[model samples]
Target chain A: MNSLKQMLPEVAPPSREALLEGRGRLVAEARDEAASAGRSRLLKRRINPWTALTAGLVAGTLGVGAALAVQIGGDHRPPERVRLVSAAEVLSRASAVAGADGAARHGRYFHYRWQEISLPDEKSRHVLGSGESWVPAGGNGRGLQRMQPCTEGNAPDCDVVLNYKDGATDREGFTGPRSPKYLRDLATDPDALLARIRRTAKGDGTADDRAWREITDLITESVGTEPKLRAALFAAAAKIPGVVADMNTKDAIGRPGIAISRPGRSPQQIIFDRGYRLIGDRTLAVGKGGPEPGTVLSAYVLVNEDVVDRLPAPRPGLVR
Target chain B: MTLPPALEVRDDANELDMISHVNEQVATDDEIVTWSLRDPEVFATLYDRHAPAIHRYIARRLGPDLADDLMAETFLLAFRQRARYDTARTDARPWLYGIATNLIGRHRRAEGRFWRAIARSGTDAATESLAERAADRVSAQMSLPALTAALARLSKSQRDVLLLTAEAGLSPVEIADALGVPKGTVHSRLGRARRKMREALGGIDPLDPREDAIDE
Candidate 1:
């Protein structure tokens, strides 16, 4: 460190003359570029003055006509506009609802759907869809929707079904009939889950599959309801180096939502509604060993308000 | 309140005018950017304002040659992107540093190699080589390699905060803005980096009370 400090003395400050010279040169270059671009624009206008004059005249005429119309307007009063309530106000309202147990249970969940609309040259629009579903708390939650079948050229049919299980535990457990059919079914039994994941992952003999298995194991090892554990999971995820969480604010349906993006590789978006309630999440895996060409990964939706009355009592467990 | 006629008619008028002229010339950085957009020559004023400190920072990190290139690149990139520049930020140093950081990222491998070479050489090339200066140089050199090696081991974010605060002379908030991170994150990373550096430097912690007293 002393040696490094010694080196520090030799680190002379930059020469004032050289810096000034560089600054002058940069200024000169920028001025030249701007001047050239300006000259080009002037030349173009000079070559076609008629078009410019016509456009200017039309614009001037429109301005005068609009001004006169406004002066002689039938209704000078501005239209009544609805003011947008701030996020803070919405959160305060949600907090108040949470404070009242009855109001909390009466909460309804509104789902906001979005799709990517592609354009030419790799540009795409993240367009919000008109389709929405309202799931009410303490209701029999079941719905049927058209889904893609396994057969090719199959028409949209009522193939997909959504069922809301009341009085269900939020804990990680297999949904549907309780049977150890696949690897996920044994997740509740930690030892069995670990053994099966390891065995099956080894047999799979693919790097991507192994990575998934390892991630699953890590998640299982770090799973729990404890806030400390959740924070630990976030920290651990950050340690993976390339993974970054993109947090942005957006309106999910009518409710304020946060869109947390995992971009590029296995891009995913997790939307959290106002009051930090989990709303819906979608992921698109587009690289090697993940999903067929243009195949989106399975999406999950959780409407907190709809499941408020049905959510089982909290189970105590250490996160990690 | 009226001045004496003689005094009022004296060189004070010229002096006051000069002061106001200087003030107008050395306006806020945001004002400079807006002026630069209209007249590119205005950017030279900003380069004059910030280049000394920025040059010194680059010099300390990568030595003179690389520092020159980095400094030039930083200003050039800033000039090219001037159209998209946010005029709201009065202080342009953070924006300049952000550009510098991106340039530094590209040369990360070279940086690691430079540090390793310094560690192996037992003394940085910038250190004094005079016989009379040998004792101090040796002492400094002995610990420097270890320090550089340790610095090389730190995470990019940790290194960024440490270097920005210590060498670039930026405040924590400035560092946060440069890195596009929360201020709390900057503070924590600085603390962690300092601790790690101390630990790596055989427990001669810069923030420790005994060391602080010694420096004082």
Candidate 2:
């Protein structure tokens, strides 16, 4: 039925500007991560001068950050207050409210209606772009998508589709390409879990920065673990060596929250609300176009999330 | 889209910034992956080269928001698995589509609803409204509910083959590759799908319930 072809219009590419802006961040991250495979290869062949030098530099970076944090606090371990509180302190406090209830539902899903606002870091005449979507709880299974491409000069153009994340348990992350089942099987001791996660962590950073970023992945997007696991995840985060506190930050939703950031060439910020719940994150994108490099490339604020039996569709009025 | 003061924070301690200039070289996706093993920076080149299409493909199936989110996941997973990429397969598009399809399959119900909604209305209001090119828009409009309804009636496997062929412009071999099925299986599924579609559209009353039961 060619008639059906007409109904299923040709899918459009995202606006040229939106593609460039968003894709810029992904490319940069890929570049950084891709190098890890080679780095590990070098690490395997111990005693190479360059490898030794790189190792020394990484160790030096972590060593300095941890030394300073510990020096400021003195001889007090867990249950002992980390006087230099950061994400660890906030996460530890939040974990107390933890429970083992998974995100599964009884003939229901965690439905979310969301909007994406894409802003450019360059002055390339790319107007801001915004799009909306409605997703089912998990892959309810079946259908087609008609992606409408938004181009420059056509401000309102955008595509929409439906999603339920296909019921991924641990959600998706770089921590060893494992599933939520992996998290479910993790030890209750946050330290043991952190060690296991560290094995999967990439980057040329200290143990702390690597672990901190991994923790950020867990609480932010993935189907957050059970309460006890979440608590373990946060307590584990506290132990990351270089995590620094940033009490003055807000989520993409503009809600105030405590932020824990790991310093690097491109620092990543993870935000949590006063209630200790995860909210959102921001990354400093240093692209070629902007006058100054550090632009907030991509970020999202969790506006609302709830468990409902029926897939939630935004009222016709809210459809952008 | 400047950030509010509270949402924007920076670290002066990060003095060693990545070189803003990326010396990009034209290379096959395989070469890029190979180079990435030597220099991670090369992965960004692959990202810049391909993520837009990947994003659109996902957006078409799931919508923009999830497209944005899943696009990131797709790349990260791709990055982790780069070592396993078959160098002979220079074009990464099929592989990327496969990754996206698996992700889409996860939310099969949402996709079904999206397709049904368009089918019921016989049009997508949002796209139709701004599709300045009236001629192209008109053809894609007019009547599509029958197609969507028939699509919904097909088993998920059959429907996937049809969409990959129709929507993604993939060949039978690519569809087989993307779905991890044999080429023969892809052809069979597509053949059955086309037959059912022909019956649905060719018949006077596509909406008839009796017609839908013939395939099963």
Q: What lDDT tens digits, residue by residue, belong to model 2 across residues B1-216? A: 111111112222221122222221235676666545544544654665567678767766666666777777777777778777767777777777788788888888977886677677765432424223323443332345666677877877887787777656678888887889999999999888878877776642322234323223
- The residue-level lDDT of candidate 2 at A304 comes to 55
Which lDDT tens digits does candidate 1 get at residues B41-115?
556556756765677666656666677677877888888887776777878998888778778877887667666
Q: For model 1, which pairs clash?
A: A1-B143, A1-B144, A2-B140, A3-B140, A3-B141
Task: Give the runs in model 1 whose Cα sits over 4 Å from its true position.
Answer: A1-10, A16-21, A44-320, B1-25, B126-142, B202-216
Candidate 2 residues lying further than 4 Å off, grouped into runs, are A1-6, A15-25, A31-46, A49-320, B1-25, B125-142, B203-216
Query: All models: lDDT?
Result: 0.47, 0.55
Candidate DockQ scores, in order? 0.08, 0.06
Task: Please provide, for model 1 over A214-275, each residue's C-alpha lDDT reduced to its tens digit, 9 standing for 90 to 100.
Answer: 43233322211222222322222222322322112332222334333323433344444533
Worst 10 residues of 1 chain B by lDDT: B15-24
TM-score (C-alpha) between model 1 and the true structure: 0.42
Q: Judged by DockQ, which candidate is best?
A: 1
